[model samples]
Target: MTRTTALVIAVAMTFTAACGGGDDAAPETTAAPAASPTTAAAEPDDATDDAVTDDAVSDEGTNDDPANGATDEVAGDDPPTEEPAGDDSSTDDSPVADPEPADGFSWRAPADGEPILIGMVNTEGVPGLDFPEMRTDLDRAVAYLNDHGGLGGRPIVMEHCRAAGSPDSSQECAQSLTGKGVDMVLLGLDIFPGYTTFSAAGVPVFGALPILRSDYSADAQFVTGGNLTTMGVIAAIAVEHIGAQSVGIVSADNIGANTSETDLTNALTAAGIDYVSIKGGDNETDAGFQALIREAAAGDPDLLVSLYSDAGCIGAMRGRALLGIDTPAISTAICAGSDVLDVVGDDAAGWMFVGVGESDDSMASIEFEAMLDDGSGDGASGAGLGALAVTMIGTLARVANMLAADGVAVDGDAIAAVMASGDAPGSFPNGETIHCGVVAAFPSVCGFSLPVGYYTDDGDVATLPGFDSVSAIDYLP
Candidate 1:
């Protein structure tokens, strides 16, 4: 393949974890890039396969009443007391009436207020991996926040540093931002996180998602959990929703991929579900993919999970179709991309997904899309990791607003404390309820719940009933 083609494929590989693990994911404690992931299946030359087999053993408040769409109290909670009917009269009542409902946040910046410096570090300018859209979308989100309410009337000034796909580069960016006295640092697809640097400098760190294994155990905080959480949730879905006793997982054979696979296996074992795993490389031929699928289905498991992304997604789907294996399958949101759908076509039907949700026309959605359009010149769209960056900024603004409303200073330490203490509000834009520090191994994953959905015959996504906001904290390692 040409250099440009290889780079393009690499970008697509990074779009989702191509093989249970991320194509661009670096090992923990190191920032070295992995081999470039391929977008096309190579022609099968040999017929040799390696397999490893192992067998192993929500929200606060009321639960969702599926019958009436109402909240049901927990089994042991005291029942709410009912007031007397038609008790409109009151003794010694004032002339005040109830206040009007709020439309939305309308906090405006104070006159000539000081700017709060928020540091950001993102990977960019790398040969096969670049994500400037992350910074662009975050800038727009900050702009939106400034226009609405500038972090308790103190305008936010973003201090952006670019990392060139290496640990040294990431460290340099962290040092530069810390030297500037930034309040806290936000990470965007940074392979080598500088948590120690920020912690030593007494600066809090926040990121959209935990991309590396080090991120899971880092002192820093992340709003979204990547492979670790996603896989765990998928395992939850397999047991709770699909009612599958046996699950077969097909994954790529990479360090990151194996780590994620182990997470799924552990979750399954904890849930008392049987699971089998099959592995392959990023560049598998059509026949090779079919062979892997056939092997995974050999045991006639109740569910099949494909942890492939990019071209791997297409290969898995096509392999299932070619083999006529109609067993219900599950995959990640990476496979839900338009590029994959356009190629997989109807073959993607009956495939449930983790980390994928149906689109809505809610006001929040409209506002988010509008922000993306408003900053189109800066490549501000909801493709790739741009929307995630925006989510990070919005989440920060939300915590700051909450703190300010309570007469607390809108500083990095306070925000970080609230997040670490699990008192932060719902994630911005989507408002997914989050619980931080719930999983000991994944203390940084504040947003542990994920929306589960499936692809339709027309390639449209739809949410699975009773699977919305599935939490993986119980299954996390």
Candidate 2:
């Protein structure tokens, strides 16, 4: 199914699934970027593939009453006293991104002011959704902004909303955040297609990168990132960086994928790479993934780019390990997480993925130190990986804070603008902010481009891509 369909189905059935590994992620410790990732170039599989999902956390953390929609409790807390934001809206399926940003509006403070509450929502270790480590990373991001900057003299107050097991609950969560009179919202619709709800609520979210393509700029929405165009960029990276003359395409077996497949194929062709697929990138199984990887690997492509997930990463690692297909495996930002690096151990050594943030441009380094002070350094390599994660968290918050400081007044729109075309400069890698979002196509923003490193490897596992690239390209996305 497409992202939206998948979400709809996931929510409609009241089924809970675990995604990404839990606290199993250990931070990297070795210093600055070293050892750029090596893919050993070639072609990808002719057959398509998919990503993997983990088991969801207990009902207590997210919501026990899956059938009840978004009235979730705080796991350990008593019953919630608030009314629910019922699932009550529909959406269209056009990938056309919201318009390019218009001339921005300057802040004109209205004298008498009550604090404008900004409602923020993220995957704060949501029960089933663990891929986006919101709490340790995202939470620190907010703190950094508030402590160092504080939005234009008005402090930002955030309410952490949990993602529901079902899409109904997802809508509920969005509605609930809207009902709170949040001036703007920073949200992600990947785990919850709450776009419809937010749109209906007339809340213009700014920071979220929704997986589904809806009217973000309508009275209902606002989007900033280089939307549908990014697909071509993704394909180009697979062809150039991964050196794949030929690639096996994989997509979610849903309407959304169907809509985009033609464009993706055309883009790949325009980029001068060969691609072929038979659907089934969104929903998949371990055994199916293994067979799929085998088929893809058989193509002997220099790069193995799969639209897969952590679970699928695991399966692909195992499948390749079983068959010994050691070419580099590249994927989207969706699967990019520090934890994913540790999932397959030695097998994960050469795994390459993509996503936002410039190495120097992001706040991961600064946040790492902060996390160390906050005690997240315990089991982790302490400052090493913990530091990196802290930096990642700090990066997002810094961007959010900057938008807030500029008084852009919308989370999704501001973040999207920054991601797609924000032009202000900030620290990245060694400290450089070249473009607004990620200027050129993103193999970098699509991923951190980390080389395989381990504490036991006796080399720097903490830093990625030979340090210089961190500053050279700027990892901030």
Candidate 3:
């Protein structure tokens, strides 16, 4: 079974009470089921409230619906998840040559014998908007992946392409990665045309950005973080957890935020969760935030979800504060900058935004920290970096793992075979790693999402103000 199916089972067992209706012009955050009898039962409870303390990837254990592979179980329609863009239909499926351990697609000296090579690709130079420490952390993490025994004991030969924000550049980058004789395409950033080209060339790629355009095709070419469906699932979770009856959605028109908005709306509808929606409310500066505040407040949503970068996203935050709105905001990694939270100050106190790591998650934390200490293997590094860091490294690991599973000599067929076995169990560098097929289907994303961490107090920075995060539960799932 897929994650979606498992989520349905989970929901069937847990939240059937909330299945009725009522609309009282309630705040968006205070979702109501139209005053129906089912509304009272489906209402949020203290136990569920207690479960919201951390944001690391929880649901670590199994659910009754075990068909969705292992560990992808999520809550039902009361929510969901996004991916990428591309025409991946007509690609050449040629096998590539893995050269010696040094050049592109070359293998490394084995611990006990010969060498094997796995090809990886990265798109360099997309802007970073997450944390101050994330960019460098990502660079270091990739290097660390190389330093350790590459994938499956093979040294990874990587080709890096630069789109430089231009279509021509993106195409050039794609061609360059393809030309390097890679078994698979790895991504730093992605371009739709470039993505289609590579897919047409028969290269299976993985990316940090959710860019997969094909979801149902058995022969689709690329894999992304997820599809738009996952975003919907996440939104449902947010509405249910935040007790949100209304929500406002906005984006700054990047690959990240574009996918975020679509899925958010879908999730709301999936769970019958109502929302007041908007667009491009960058939450960066005071002015931008102020404008977003005007737009968001008109609908009287108790909750806000900003899907832009820091600069613009902060603007939305400022606008809300200036208007004296107490709506709790929920944002994605891109919009969840410390600056936005800082500017919001006391109002930012209870505001919740999603992050990839947890403050007190001991199990996954121990594994991630071990990789950091050991300098990280062909594993996902920077889990504790910013949200983007976790995402980027996770993507990298997915690509590397794909190459290894298909062996040094791989083609589109081999690569797809490895990826199509979505969520196949593996001891990945991250807490638990799973492969997602063709990026289109978004097999297990929702069932495996992280949570929101708070910043320090009203006066300081970060999600926690009164206690030192180093000593607190800094890794929670």
Query: For residues 1-477, could you state the per-residue lDDT of candidate 3 as single tens digits?
Result: 110000010110000000000111222233221111010000011112122221111121233232211111211110001111121334588554433221111122222212322233332333431122332333333334444334444343333333333455556666665665556654433333365676777776544333334322322322223324234324543444455676776556544455455556766766566776665422345665566667866887656766554455456556666787766665543333334444555554434434322222222232233223322333222222222332344334444445655564433345445545654323122222335532333442212233323333322222212111111011111
Worst 10 residues of 1 by lDDT: 32-41
Better of 1 and 3 by TM-score: 1
Worst 10 residues of 3 by lDDT: 12-21
Error of 1 at 307 (Å): 1.3
Tens digit of per-residue lDDT, candidate 2, span 1-477? 111100000000000100000111223432221222121001112111122122222122232332222112111111112211221123366453321111110111211223345554543243333323333333433343344332332344555465533455555567677777776665432344466677677665543222333422322221222223334434545544455677665545554445345545665666677766545555466667667777766666665555444465466556555667666555433333334435655565454432222221122322233332433333212211122233332334345545655666534456445644545323211222323324343311312222111222321132223311111122122
Candidate 3 Cα misplacement greater than 4 A, ranges = 1-139, 193-202, 212-230, 250-260, 279-288, 339-346, 359-416, 426-448, 456-477
How far residue 476's Cα lies from its native spot in candidate 1, in Å, is 1.9
Give the runs in model 2 whose Cα sits over 4 Å from its true position. 1-116, 122-132, 135-137, 163-175, 189-203, 215-233, 249-266, 278-290, 333-340, 356-364, 368-374, 379-422, 426-477
Residues 1-477, candidate 1: write the lDDT tens digits. Answer: 111001110111122211011122212332111111001011111111122111100011122322211112111111112212222236467553321111123223331246677777877766434667776656655655566555655676666777765666777777888888988888876767678899999999987776666777898877777666677777788777767789888988875566667778988888888988999987788898899899999999888888777688899989998999888887776566566776888888777667554444333444454444442244223424566676666667777777777788878888888777767777655566556677776787777766665665445555555555677777765
Cα deviation at 292, candidate 1, in Å, is 1.8
Give me the candidate number with maximum TM-score: 1
Deviation of model 2 at 453, angstroms:
11
Candidate 2, poorest ten consecutive residues by summed lDDT:
5-14
All candidates in order of TM-score, best leading: 1, 3, 2
